[model samples]
Target: MNIETLTWGTLDIKDEQIYHFPKGIPGFEDDIDFALITVEDGPFSYLQSLQNQSVSFLLSDPFVFYPTYEFQLPESDKEELEIADLVNVRCMVTIKEELESSTVNLLAPIVLNPVKRSGKQVVLHNSNYQTRHGLWNVSQDHFEKGGE
Candidate 1:
């Protein structure tokens, strides 16, 4: 299938590669169908919407930056996605940057079932997690002083 994207322009995508988010993301309820397109020679990916050409999100695996990161979804959510094993899941986070710091939402991770091609944005109820978790900046003096 040929997909029209805002970032990558027109591209071909296999039908099986399309991910369906029945409930959509928190703010993008109407745009449920998306394709994960990796930008050429780039670390980020574009979650390009099939329903709306303008709707797209830059995503990346949270573990790439925060190896110790953890995510948990409620039993009901698991049942909804028909998730039986962790191996079938692929997790990603939407990136956000602020002046000197870049942050990813550790509290809400977008979980996808590759086999089923379905996904959901699950908000962790864990108290230790936050909506905006800053990335590690080695250049900061406080980080060198063991402030991380």
Candidate 2:
């Protein structure tokens, strides 16, 4: 379906790309549907809202930046997203900007269940991870290193 995006002028996404967030992404409780799109050869991507064209988030695989980053999928989140195997899950972090000084949200990773076409932003409640981890820490040889 065709959608007017917050970043991209307009986009046509496949039905398979659509994800339903029943509880929404924390503060965005009213916006439930979204489409994941890649940023043309770049490490970044976007989680664009199908429900509200104006709402979109620039995302990136946090692992590429902080290789040590990890989190447990609270059973509540797993049930909510209907997540089964680890292969069925994908993680994307919010990229605040492109500058080295910019930050990425590592504490709350957005998890999507491709098999169920559902998603949720799993907030790591009591972790040392921060919401604004500097982007400069990203590995310079991203392509040389494999990704999930």
For model 2, how big is the CA root-mean-square deviation? Answer: 5.3
lDDT per residue, candidate 1, 75-101, as tens digits?
A: 888888778775232344444454336
lDDT of 2: 0.75
Those runs of model 2 whose alpha carbons end farther than 4 Å from true positions after fitting are: 87-98, 138-148
27 Cα displacement, candidate 1 (Å): 0.8
Clashing residue pairs for model 2: none
Residue range with the least summed lDDT across 10 consecutive positions in model 2: 139-148
Q: Supply the TM-score for candidate 1.
A: 0.80
lDDT of 2 by residue, 1-148 (tens): 8999767787899998898989888888999998988788767878888888888887887777777777777888888777888523234454345566677777788888888888888778877766766676555354235321
